[model samples]
Target: MSAPGGNWGFRTGVNDFWGEDHGRKTIGKTILVTGGTGFIGGAALRALADSEPGTNIRVLSRQPLPESLRTGEVLHVHGDLTDPSSLRGVCEGVSTVLHLASHVGRDPELCDVVNRHGTTALLADARRHGVSRVAYMSTTAVYGHGVHRGLTETGVNPLPVSPASRSRLFAEQAVRGFGGIVLRPHLVYGVGDVWFIPTLLRLLNRVPSWIQDGAARVSVVCVDMLGEVLSGLTRIPWRGGETYHVSHPRSTSFRSIVRTVCSTLRLDLPSRSLPVAEHREISRGMMPELTDHQHELLASDHWYDSSRIWRKVRQCPGPGFSSRFARAADWYRDLLPIG
Candidate 1:
């Protein structure tokens, strides 16, 4: 689905949706966004370009991206997160840094290098340059497995299930010491999402419906909302070493998500539910390295309390929450038949 209001046009009135003046004048500082070519990072870059023009925006990446992804006079810096020396000049003259670059997924060593080592390196450099503030993009997966009915920011019951999650938790601690704001977004989804949606669709195509009990609840946030939160981070005064959970206020059922995907793609919905235990056993055998915590995440419920975030930055007051979900589903539909 395309962005509403047609043609992905740039928005000028910052106050039109959220009733907040996030105009260029309010943004009095330069910003640097790592992983700006990625989905969520790209969204944040676009929002900043529209709302905070004239603010020096730099994107840190190892390689060049398409011209279309480059929004509004963005300066691209060629650097790898694994190399600390390369990040020296990247953070120079930048007042704020949004750390979104990390190695996610199955590779343990790579995750350690990018998520743990890379974060530490960046934080050190930011401190050296005396950057005013920083926002580190973390995942709710750090909480790890089981029902999180009303998970809050203070909660730190991280299950060391996957290498990625473990490394992120470690990185969070390091970032906290550097006076960095850590944002833990649950299940971020949107257009240009090559990770979450494609993986879910593949699982849907391969597995039976009952494997996850069809009742698990998961918290989620649209990329647009996440972008707003990231941008707001630079303005708000963050409590040193504090973490904030970023998610849509409501928790949606796993079954509902599957149904939504099927409905959007005009595909047949799965009718049978497989026994949870049996599915777990099969999955473990197939993916032996997959941590038990990660496996448990499939059938687990992780609902976050986003009240603090809402109080800090007003959500875009447009349609109801369902409208956001529909937008995500529409985006998913447009990128179909992927290999």
Candidate 2:
């Protein structure tokens, strides 16, 4: 659950979750963002507002957001993806639908209702409204278990172990039928990531580094870079129903990432590596719901190949990707409130 006062319990003194300028052109186009109030969704909306001034941008949020939180140029529509009928008007006059809404958890039923059923409903509405294109935000977890080194968009499903991953994969298949684009981004980290980065920090405090195979290389991309890529999808003409793995050119080692966090906080890095067998035993003992697929992720590498996406979109042409980690550290240090 979210923290009290609408805060996501983010660490005090971090300033890493703001939007950047992408300089996109939105002439005569109306775009809809499903999860505009969310971290990545908010960033996408801000980028669009900055790049294309005066464009008709609409956000479908469950709760009404304060004016200061919005782009001022955006139209806020109160709606829920769980109810397909509520999404009808939300898709009206929207030529491009960026479906970023999703539910992440261990509950398979809840995951299906939101990720699978919600996506199905959204696509139906988009098709009904005659939307020209769509960009569906998905996770690399859909690829599932084992060492996913150099995995590409077209690679075989390694193994979907978690309820979240299975539901997401099902959602991907459902959306693909509509001829829309699906992007699986791995380890999306940025300032406003209350779940991803903060969760890692918490796990670091609780668990030993050996569980994740300290040297395992994992692919990651900054939320900002993902936003830019989302914007590119709108501008670039591509075949519908294609899946792209969005990530930075290089991968980060599990140990190095943890060490970075420890160094940033002036804390000592964990030296003990939990043996694979012991790690599994401990995980099952603690999180009995831990699926076989999720276990594979912790013990093995889950990297991806982004050559196809890079070849088409061209390199981001700036330091947007590399600067994200440092920016995250800065955000955690500056914007987060101190006790």
Best by TM-score: 1
Error of 1 at 181 (Å): 0.6
Ten contiguous residues minimizing lDDT sum, candidate 2: 1-10
lDDT of 2 by residue, 35-135 (tens): 77787787787677766676667777777766755665777776776666666645655667788878777888888888888788778777766664778
lDDT of each residue in 57-163, candidate 1, tens digit only: 77888777669766566777777777776766556566678888777777899889888888877877776666646788889888766778888887657776678
Which window of 10 residues has the lowest lDDT sum in candidate 1? 1-10
In candidate 1, list every pair of residues with a backbone clash: 1-330, 1-331, 210-273, 210-274
The total number of steric clashes, by the backbone 3 Å criterion, in model 1 comes to 4
